[model samples]
Target: MNIENKIDELISLINYHNEKYYNQDAPEISDAEYDNLMKELIKLEEENPNLKRVDSPSNRVGGKALDKFDQIVHKIPMLSLSNAYSGQDLKDFDKRVRDMAGSDVEYVVEFKIDGLSVGITYNDGEFEKGATRGNGVVGEDISQNLMTVKSIPLRIKEDNEIVVRGEVYISKENFQKINEQQENLGLALYANPRNLAAGSLRQLDPKLTAKRPLDIFVFNLEYGQNLKFESHSESLEFLSDLGFSVSPSYKVFKSIDDVIEHIEYWTENRGNLDFEIDGMVIKVNNLKQRETMGYTAKSPRWAIAYKFPAEKKKTKILDIIVEVGRTGTITPTAVLEPVRLAGTSVSRATLHNEDYIREKDIRINDTVLVQKAGDIIPQVIEVVKEERNGEEIGFNMPNNCPVCFEPTVRLEGEAAVKCINMSCPAQIRRGIIHFVSRDAMNIDGLGESIITLLLNEKIIEDVSDLYSIKKEDVINLERMGDKSANNLIKSIKKSKENDLWRLINGLGIKFVGVKGAKILAKNFKDIDEIMNASEEELVNLEEFGGTMANSVVEFFKEDKNINVIEKLKKASVNTKTIEDKNSNVPKIFEGMKIVLTGTLPTLKRNDAKEMIEARGAKATSSVSKSTTFVLAGEEAGSKLTKANELGIKVVDEATFIELSSLSSKEEVESKLLL
Candidate 1:
């Protein structure tokens, strides 16, 4: 076959597999096989550039990086939906619809996906452009970024020009993965999935957007040239038939009462879904009825969204306490009467700081409304002042550190009250915890509990003392056996050989995280070099601001910190750069299917998954016959047993690390095969 024909065939095959994996959730080919096909197509396209098709699957990897997105005026307005917060509000909407369109109206209810709205246009069965829903009429063109979403088909079976509206979103699982990556890099966490999805889609560089996990659920057939549909449900069916991922829970209801009942059911059960939905949309099923109902000034009269109320509970604030952090920042926490919230028991909530408490007038022995902020963090929504009694007492920030009794001071223009004593036991304890975190020195078997125990037992004084811990000392501790103690000592020894960047992050330097540490490690040869660097020099480095530079200089200037560093150096901990800073990670596990089970000693499940995926491995949730390896950790359960029964290779964290260190695919294969 000709090169062009071969390319076409490859594109078709890849697209098919993509749809199967992304949309259908059933894949016929292995990830490696799919990757090989893509590689071949890319090679052919590079050789014969002019012959490359616009609808090729290779476009999903992304194209040229753009400095800015062009603005596009939407042909049809993307109207917002009127919301119904209560059953009465929904009933009122139903009554209004019945008054205009008659009592025989059928309603189609679908999940109101909490995501960014976008419109994709197709011409002659090929994707033409995609734009965001901005101001209802105008939007930024994000065609290149939209093209990277695999669930979005590059070509469809439809011949006529059409515009489809979809909600571009990140799944809850992928959102957690993204946050894990952010935490590993020491970046600020995104508030929620909707904000993250919007930020990702609006990224200036398509390559950056391509790296994010994005999916779309096409809901409305916005425009279809020379096409007619009898009902809204029919149009959705047509779109689904064209390989578009649509709402799986859309149902037609005969009565408004039934619609409200379904909405109530979903309102309580929506947490079971993989994606997020803020509400349920009730739309007139009949297209003719929709036309009769017509559009309002801002939203459609025929459709309304029944929004779920933020789950809140009234609980008594038992007490307010403060805790010292690694940075010596004292944080106020409210101990609450245990209440079930967002499917979990909520016993404690962050009060943020002293100013927050003063502003909210939070008190001990007072009733307060509590809710999960972004459905993740428990927070005090408001105080139930009406229920306050004479016994309730307003809480005050501590004048001194609770643990070390050092005088606390609030700095100018800062909300935090901090204890400046570097040798404070609370600060040291928290600092040691930070030092041994997965993103820092990555010492396994030294969890927060273990660190606390070691501190209270006086087995270790600070982060530097961890390297000197003996297995015999650990074995004598309560609940620690010979094997556990041995593992702990080994992990500490292993961490001493870690790269300079990890050591820098492990230092818990003010305003210097993993990403900043990497930048410093890349620019400077050793920790001493960084310590000696001028603030002006640091400020000039990429991504470093004046505040961060000052913080770095200030942290290194401390005599206590210098003492700790000297101790670490004496213990022979690696403090110098060892590898090329800009080198790409080898895809040692490429084409491998790995399953992770139980509690990993050093890495969280998501962290381990992210690490493997970075090195080109598919980390599956379940063990299967095709699984290349089962990475079993402490307390491994059914998955590990199943892997053994299937005769699949079972590896521990140490073995996994050995496999990851292999430089070539051949080396990885040989290791796995053995």
Candidate 2:
């Protein structure tokens, strides 16, 4: 592509990725890839200033502020840092600092946390406001969401009006957990921790933000009216002493060589940390030196960031094969010569789909670049087409399913080809595995190995067969003991008594997950009711989209599915809501709209929602003028904030429990209104 076309394309692509990363919490490309694009665009713009668009994404630090929250105009702008990509750049920076300060300036090097930047202000030892770094000068007020992050202290030790800057992030472990939950719900996975943290903090409901494991590291004491410190490290120490989580290990260096050494050390050890760090921040330690060094229009001249290189390797594509998932989608895998990447030996990489392969012109015997996406899944980057010496052969997708030999089909406007055969063995095996997964039926002692063994022995042909497996049949399998067999049988039986939503989720219905199953179960009394419900009826319910509704209706429409349901019924599995066994209990809070906030004393937030839902009250996520009351718990956040502002009645958890225990709607109303 020519320079102008490439610049335009990069602008469009970066804007799309910015929306994906900041607003949607899903990114199609890796951060390094996005940064390279930005760098190329910037280079082109610098070379040809007339070609730059007035509204180019390169001009912005983040996505536009969301309108769901109040806007906060920053008292002091949150400036970006100029970056130094190599040792020479660092040396140049050190020389500039020395020239400006007229001395050998000490520098503090700290990890540049990969997360959303925010400015938090405190008044008289209490947190007053928290805002994101939206366009640097203006930001969205996210005080409630910030409060949900446990690492941010609501009340500091010092009684002064102060402003601090920090990075809000999610831990790698929590990011994995959240992605797992998303996969179970059949939703698109988040790309990385930074995106997830930003999306979580921007949620309109503080309750939703509370569910995300977000943390913060205070690095800059922007405006401390009553506090005075000589150096950046001293300010960090004061912030840490006031219970603010500070950045991880940092050091003072007198030479640029030492700074480069620290950067190299972290480049090699970045994977060791629980949180993600894209680079290291090198700053002039002395506050006076920083003031003298001063600022540019958008970034500070006193500080520089050294970014790590993208990790990639070149390998040969040995072959491409397809695997059928539980949902019947055929995914292509690239078998390759084993190569080490990100501390793992990767022999296979994801091709994504047929479209991706065709777009990249990937062929057999072709050399291709590869990288570990998110430091987890391996993926092919691009083909080295020049290396092909007329030996590479173009690939074609199979016309039939690999496992069952059933005719495969690609739906219109969709990229994935799927096997529609209900009884495909691959589908059955994967579905059974999912059914016993912890997020589904949660059957203990029933793992993939035992299921595979049972399938091979013809003891179970499908999920329904699992419920009917006898102890004698299980005990006969290899590595099966009497005690193990009994435990397995007991576990299977216990699963039969799980809430109807579990059974619904365990059915492997496409697009209908834990949340969908709960909505279905609450609306319909039993499996039969759900099976008979029309698509319109399903779609009419809250949280049910048109596609999800159609999937549910189509899944139950199949005679084979009906047969499985019959088999499950014959095995005495409870297909109805088990929690609502007491039909005699009155829906005392019927038609009432209640909002729950903060951590309850003895009940989880979800459990509390269910309890209120059982009593015929709607458990709304956000507070508004229409809300009946706010159930305030310890550390009540933004919901309580808005509720009080709107003159809505707010009650303690004790009062909430007392009102819930009331037997009649009249008594409940009287107890609250009186």
Poorest stretch of ten by lDDT in candidate 1: 598-607
Write candidate 1's Cα lDDT for 426-536 as tens digits: 999999998999899999888777898999999899999998888887898876899999888888989888989999998988888977887898899999999999999
Stretches of candidate 2 off by over 4 Å are 1-106, 110-278, 287-310, 476-483, 580-674
**Candidate 1: stretches off by over 4 Å:** 16-33, 184-187, 313-320, 323-331, 335-348, 352-369, 372-378, 381-674
Clashes of each: 0, 0
- Please write out the lDDT profile of model 2 over residues 287-342, one tens digit for every residue: 98889989875468899989776667889999988899898889999999988565
Instruction: Count clashing residue pairs in model 2.
Output: 0
Model 2, residue 51: distance off in Å is 76
TM-scores for all predictions: 0.54, 0.53
